[model samples]
Target: MPNAPAADQRRLLDVQALDTRLDQLAHRRRTLPELARIAELESQLADLHTALVTSQTAVADLRRELAKAEADVQQVRDRAARNQARLDAGQGSAKDLQALQHELESLAKRQGDLEEVELEVMERLEAHEAALAEVTAAHTQLVDGKVQVESERDAAFAQIDAEVAGVQSERATAAAGLDAGLTALYDRLRGQLGGQGAAALRGRRCEGCRLELNPLDLDAIKAKPEDAVVRCEECGRILVLLPEDH
Candidate 1:
């Protein structure tokens, strides 16, 4: 059978109080609303950045295509100009002049077709550039929003950390008065029992689980000597007895 001296048993209630406060602080830290808001903002910012990158890539590709199209049109136009000068100079043989004139006409038709392609590409490039600009602006705004959210979350973390520090100090003082063996037992049982290792026996109930003891269990607990470490038969929690209340 396990037993705690009178002083150790009294400290159990203090330990339980400190442990419960610490648990509440931890739970509050995890459930802060700022944490959820920060997550939502970060998710939105990621999507905006991805959209901006896609838009910028599309604009860049179309600009390159436009550049190549313009160069092709200019190259063909220069060839036609040289052929026109040769025909105008009247220096070629008659057969050669006729061939030069025919070549000029073919170059003119090709230049017209290429100019049409250049116009289409220019329009497409303009649209893409506009889309890129809009996305870039939106992405910039989202980044700023993310920064604000981070600041809020950091501030919340600091506040919670301060509260936790205070509670930890309180718990240290409470734990110092307990017997080493009893405290170790409580720590071990807490790990297995979801953070609660002991409860007071008040009005025939184990306060940890709020279950009322039946006649047999109550009788057994009543038979134990004061200062004897007694566990609840119903829930296996170390049950503390208050002489005045019992």
Candidate 2:
């Protein structure tokens, strides 16, 4: 087994590296741009569906109105025909005939009004149908777009998962080579220090906290044994010295 302090430092470094990689993977998983686009597309699709439904309902209402108007015109024409036959038969008094003519004229006017209403309703129905076609086209486009976006998002997640799996395997291998006490200390320190237990010391600066060490601190670190573990005063992270050439 490695000495307690050296082993702890090594294990802490390994854990820090693994944790950094894990954080990167988690961030990639959560911040995919495609996911935001997918949500937007879904919302747009929902709105389009609502509009299409409303347009279809309007079209149905117009069709009903057209049918009713046609029926009314037919009923009026039938009444006019009956009135004309009664006037021609001369079986009614003059007053009765005059009333029948007035009624027939009223029926003609009502038939014309009903025909005009039917035409208007038909025109409105045609417009609604056109609008529905446009909505259906837009909906189809959105559906296809959503499918493509989802596929892209899934592919990105799959790639990230594979990377995470590889990183985990490497972490396991690294952990296996470390002493148990070192691993325990590393885990404890990492838990206490926001997932970071080790950092590199460059020149007289602590990379963990980006703070320069005082002259006394630098001298003390330099005086320590080559294999001794040192910690950063500012950040409480284990400091690893770089080689002279680095």
Candidate with maximal lDDT? 1
Encode model 2's per-residue lDDT on 118-211: one tens digit a residue: 8888898899989989998999999999999999999999999999999999888777766565566567767888777778778888878899
Worst 10 residues of 1 by lDDT: 1-10
Best by TM-score: 1
Whole-model Cα lDDT of every candidate shown, in order: 0.83, 0.82
TM-score of each: 0.85, 0.79
Residues 4-31 of candidate 1 have per-residue lDDT tens digits of 7756776787788878888887888888
lDDT, candidate 2, equals 0.82
Regions of model 2 farther than 4 Å from truth? 1-8, 78-103, 188-194, 222-229, 242-246
RMSD of 1: 2.6
